[model samples]
Every structure is written in structure tokens, then in C-alpha cells.
Target: MSPSETPEVVLHDLRAGDGLPLVLVHGFPLDHRMWDEVARFLPDGLAVVAPDAPGFGDALLTESEPSIEGIADAVAEALAARGVERAVVAGMSMGGYVALALAERHPGLVAALGLVDTKSVADAPEARDNRLRIADEAERTGSVAPVRGMREALLGETSRATRPDLVAEVGAWIEEQRPEAVAWAQRAMASRPDRTAVLAAYGGPVSVVVGVEDELTPIEQAEHLVESSHDASEAALVLVPDAGHLAAVEEPEHVAGALARLHARVTR
Candidate 1:
């Protein structure tokens, strides 16, 4: 395929394959590369595409203000550009917020939702305040330290001591993020409207994947989502063993397996 015919190789783009289209949205601090291993392990005939949010990875960082909804719109545009009318959209953490936003705003483009290690609740006032404080610190001293602290927070307690290398890798990814991008995302997340209604309102299939050891978005959060969602009885909940926030990176095989099961349930 000619380069122009293919999706732009930026922070995020469409990976070429055949069967159903699966859009993977990476969590904060990491780019689409975070999904590389999980994408490789997906079922054959699945066209896996991981799009990077603007300002992260190779995405062309414009001067636009950042918001999860804004990012979702960008993804929708990218998919339209690629002739993809609908896709099974999967997102991790912040990506989940974007996926839900996309599904809500452009109902026709999202066939299903795969929410991984994420939540449906909006940030509490304290949480939003904390984020603002962190953003201020990041702005003052660069985003690397705050992001490193965030990296530590995302990992399971055991990972800090047992999987230092993984922690380092995640920290490095955060450190590599452009400061402006990080700041923009922080503000966007703070300003985001509550999306619990989206979960309750959407009628399409939804799957919630949580890391057993996740501290950022705990199992309780997943339970809350499953209970609150419109398709609670049918929505699937997966708890990946030994994985933390970044389940796809921490336990790629387990995440891939969950995706396969969700795919079967949603597409079959």
C-alpha cells in the first residue's frame, strides 16, 4: 500500500489488517506503541489500529486545546479518512474516556466498547484539585517528575520492588512525553464533563477490563461501571491476574485473551 493510502504514522494511526477493525487507544503517558504487543497477539483477521492522541508519540501536535471529546473527534476523523465507518473501540484509562465520548457523540462509528483499567466516574473535586496541583508542579519543574510519580502510582505495589524494569520503562515513556502535551491532557481531564451518563445511555455492547492489582482504577470502580451500565447483565468484566494499570503492557497475553473473549461475545 502506498504511504498516502495508509493512515498517518503519528501518535496514533490505523494498523492494516483484514477482518473487523479494532481501534486501540493507549492510556496516559504512553503512546500507541503501548499496544504493540497486545495488537500482535489479537486474533487473526482482526485489523488492529492504535491511534496516538495528539501531542503524544509521533502525532502532529497542533495548538489545539485538548479534551477527551476532542481527541475522540480526531479519531473519528482519522477513521473516516481511512473509510472505517465503525470499529470495536478499545481504550485504556484516559483512552476509555475518549472511546466512550466517541461512541456517545458519533454513535454510528463505534460498534462496541472495550474499556481497560479505566472508570466511568468523573474526577471527584479532590481528585481534580490534585490533578491541578500536579499540573502546576509539572509546569513549574517539567512533567517528568510528576509523570514518574504517576507511573509509580499506576503500578501494583509489588511491581515497584519486583518489576523495577517495567516501572522504569513506564516512567521513561512518561518522561518522554512532551511537556505541553502533558499539561494539555491534564487540563482536559480536569475540565472533562461527567461521562457516567454515557455509560448508562449507550445501548451497544460494553466490556470492562480491570487489572487485579490496579490501584489507579480499582476493581471496585469496574464493579461500579458494570452495575451502572445499561447492559449490566450482558457486559463482561475481566480481571487480569498480576497486572496493574497498563494491563496490555504488564500482562499482554492476559489482555489479548480478554480481548478475544470480548470480541467473540460482541461480534459473534
Candidate 2:
């Protein structure tokens, strides 16, 4: 996509505070509402901007190719629209792909990074093929039912066993997504490149967060991220006990605290 063809991004701006802006990018097949729980616990004097990635939420992707780079460009444009020169970028799951893309494509715009329940490596061949299959199913059915099987995989054993209400809430969010959007997001994630180099090159404060019980993008992924950074000593890794893939929702207070610490470190 060319500069002229870039689509306008939909932003959920809570411009209620000061300090450096914190931009939150939600995961695939989900909207900015994914950050609702975590956002409430953020420290005062920090501006928060959560944007809907293209083809997800109310945002539409104008580009024919639904690449993660395209989503990153949209995020950069969204920040520009808000007059934000630089900000800490936090992303969960597929949102992590877009965050890494943003850091790689628009390095100057990212002041810091908060990666939650995500990995720096690209999808394996089998994973890519599976994603394509899921996308195809979604397109064929005109429904997100194809991916609903992942609901249990997205949460921890504890969450599944104890917090049925939270699990149901997450399922509801997943069910509300548009099939086309889900397909587009799957394709984008499938095509993403290994972004460990981006972390190795980034100089800002980095926060690597993951749920201890997360079946997908587990603790090892978070550790790898911290270890791969330019200065491993500077990176902060936080593990949320009994949480799963959706760490932000499962343990909002912990996620928010990690973010707040990262923000403080960056500002200091």
C-alpha cells in the first residue's frame, strides 16, 4: 500500500492524563475493549491510546494485502493523528505482531514496549498452514465459529475451572468478531517475520509479560524475548500466576503494574 492509500485508524483515546503516552494494541479478532480492564489500573499522568487494528473492531483495512506492516502503518498514522510524537507501545497476542512491526517500521515513534502473551518468532510452517485453514473456514462459513475451539486454549486451567464468568465473557468477545476480520488477521499473523532483531536493536525500556499457565506463548517465549533484547539486563519480565494467553484480562492488576513500572523506567 502506498502513502496515499493508507486507511484511517480507529482510536479509543482516553486522553485523561499526562506524561508519555501509552499506546495499547489489542489482539486479533478482538477490539480495543480488550484493554479495558488493564487501562483502569494505569498510573495517573499517563496518556493511553488503544487502537483497533485494521479489519478488527470498527477499523477497516483499505489495503488489499492484510500484512502486519500495513497494520503498523495504520497505528503510526493513528498516533500521528493524535499528535503523539512518541509513546510506549503495548500489545497482546497478535497485537504483539503489530507492535513489533511498528517498532521495526517506525522505530522513532516507539518510546518503549510492553509485550504481553506474545512471541518474537515467526509462525512455524505448520502453524502458518493451520492459520490459513482457519481463515478459509471463516471465509466459507461467514462466521468465527471455526476459531471458537481456541477459547479453552486461550485461558489457563485455573481460569477455565474457576472463573467461568470471565471465560464466558471472553468467549462472547470472540464470538462478536467479524469472520472477515478474523480471516484477515489470521493471514496477517501467518505472514509475519521473526522480529527478535527488532528487540535486539531497540534501546528503550522493554517489558516482557506472560501468563505462567499460558498454553500459547508461554513463559519461555517471554524469557526468550528478554534474553534476545540488546540489553537483557534492562528488560523486565513479569509472569502472572494462574493466568493464560489473555493475561491482561485474566490479571489486569498485575499487567497494569508491569506497564506502570515500564512507563516509570522509560520516563526516568
Number of the predicted model whose TM-score against the real structure is largest:
2
Against the reference, the lDDT scores of all candidates come to 0.80, 0.87
Every model's TM-score: 0.91, 0.96
lDDT of 2 by residue, 12-113 (tens): 875568768999999867889989888899987778889987767778756557688878898898778778878899999888888888889999999899
The lowest-lDDT stretch of 10 consecutive residues in candidate 2 is 1-10
Task: State the TM-score for model 2.
Answer: 0.96
Worst 10 residues of 1 by lDDT: 2-11
**How accurate locally is residue 89 in candidate 1, as Cα lDDT from 0 to 100?**
87
Candidate 1's residue-wise lDDT over 206-236, tens digit each? 8899989899999999888888788898778
- Backbone clash total for model 1 is 5
The local lDDT score (0 to 100) that residue 56 gets in candidate 2 is 71
